[model samples]
Target: MTKHRIYTTSFASVYPHYIAKAEKKGRTKAEVDQIIRWLTGYNQMELEAQLKKQTDFETFFAQAPQPNPSRASIKGVICGVRVEEIKEPTMREIRYLDKLIDELAKGRAMEKILRE
Candidate 1:
């Protein structure tokens, strides 16, 4: 089978879509950044640098400062797949981000969304 393109996709390309998804639901870019930082440990400056560098999702996640332990508490379905059930580690990380974004777009409070 052919490999999925998501793994190789540039985070820069998807960043705008994520921002738009949250903003459409009355969320702000800062909230989206917060969610990302909570998951990947990237501060605002680091995230901007990654975006400017056009980092791919694979590299972005691979080089993350630190994956939050609380992320394991994020239980939910994203694109019909249970985030906790995803077998591939990389895919699971991606889905965790997706689930968080979905929660943010659905108006979930930041504390709850961060699994705090």
Candidate 2:
């Protein structure tokens, strides 16, 4: 079966949209960065390096230093599909991120959004 096009898409390409969505809702880029750091455990420098490298989604998630255990708590629909119901590992990770961004855009508190 053909892989999803997003698998090969550079994470950097989509990151701006995540920031834009959050910023449009009166959120800050740092908040978006916090969400990414929380989910993937990437420090600021490491996250910047990944963005500079233009890493694809597959490799970006594959190389995550320590994906948070709390990410499994992320649940909701994104693009009409339930995030928890996504069976493919990579796709699920992507949707987990999408759901978090969705929550941020909806003005969810950072504490609750991180499931802390």
Candidate 3:
């Protein structure tokens, strides 16, 4: 089976778009970074390293230091698809991120966004 193109897409190429989406909605890059950190357990430094390396989405998720167990709680639609209902693991993780960013762009409180 052919792998999805996103699996090989460089994260760095998409990171700016994520930042832009949030910023256009009055959110900050720090908040986006925080969301990424919370989801993938990459500290600020490690996250920066991954961005610098321009890692692919598949590798980025696969090498995550500690993917948040709470991520299963991220239930919502992203790109018209339900994140919680996704059957593929990596795709689910990616959508979890998309949903979180959408919430952020919608101005959800950080505490609740983090599910803290």
Candidate 4:
């Protein structure tokens, strides 16, 4: 049998706090990596390459939401109401994101998401 290399332990130990922080905010690994790279002053391309080559579940974490005092307008009524565009949720078309996450967590192949 061939020997398998374990590359995640060092990263795991150092990144646990980041991962926990990210998960608490309900963000995906990719999104969290982006935010962290931005905050740490790393180039985006470098971060992307490293993320795919050397990363674990805990490496990605969501950034906490900023405490903005300004309010954005929300259209339509609060209860049993029809809105013009449905605003927030419809904006990103993220319905597929959940399915993707589930598949990844189940150890499904990630070649598809990488293509996009």
CA lDDT, candidate 1, residue 74:
84
**Per-residue lDDT tens digits of candidate 3, residues 1-116?**
89899999999999999999999999999999999999999999999999999999999999999999999898878999989999999999999999999999999999999999
lDDT tens digits, residue span 1-116, model 2:
99999999999999999999999999999999999999999999999999999999999999999999999988888999999999999999999999999999999999999998
TM-score of 2: 0.98
Better of 1 and 2 by lDDT: 2
lDDT of 1: 0.93
* Model 2: lowest-lDDT 10 consecutive positions: 70-79
In model 4, the clashing pairs are 22-61, 22-62
Model 3 segments more than 4 A misplaced: none
TM-score of 3: 0.98
Cα error, candidate 3, residue 106 (Å)? 0.6
RMSDs, each prediction? 1.0, 0.5, 0.6, 15.9
Ordered list by lDDT, greatest first = 2, 3, 1, 4
lDDT of each: 0.93, 0.96, 0.95, 0.36
Candidate 1 weakest ten by summed lDDT: 1-10
User: Which consecutive 10 residues in model 3 have the weakest lDDT in total?
Assistant: 70-79
- Greater-TM-score candidate between 2 and 4: 2
RMSD of candidate 2 to true structure, Å: 0.5
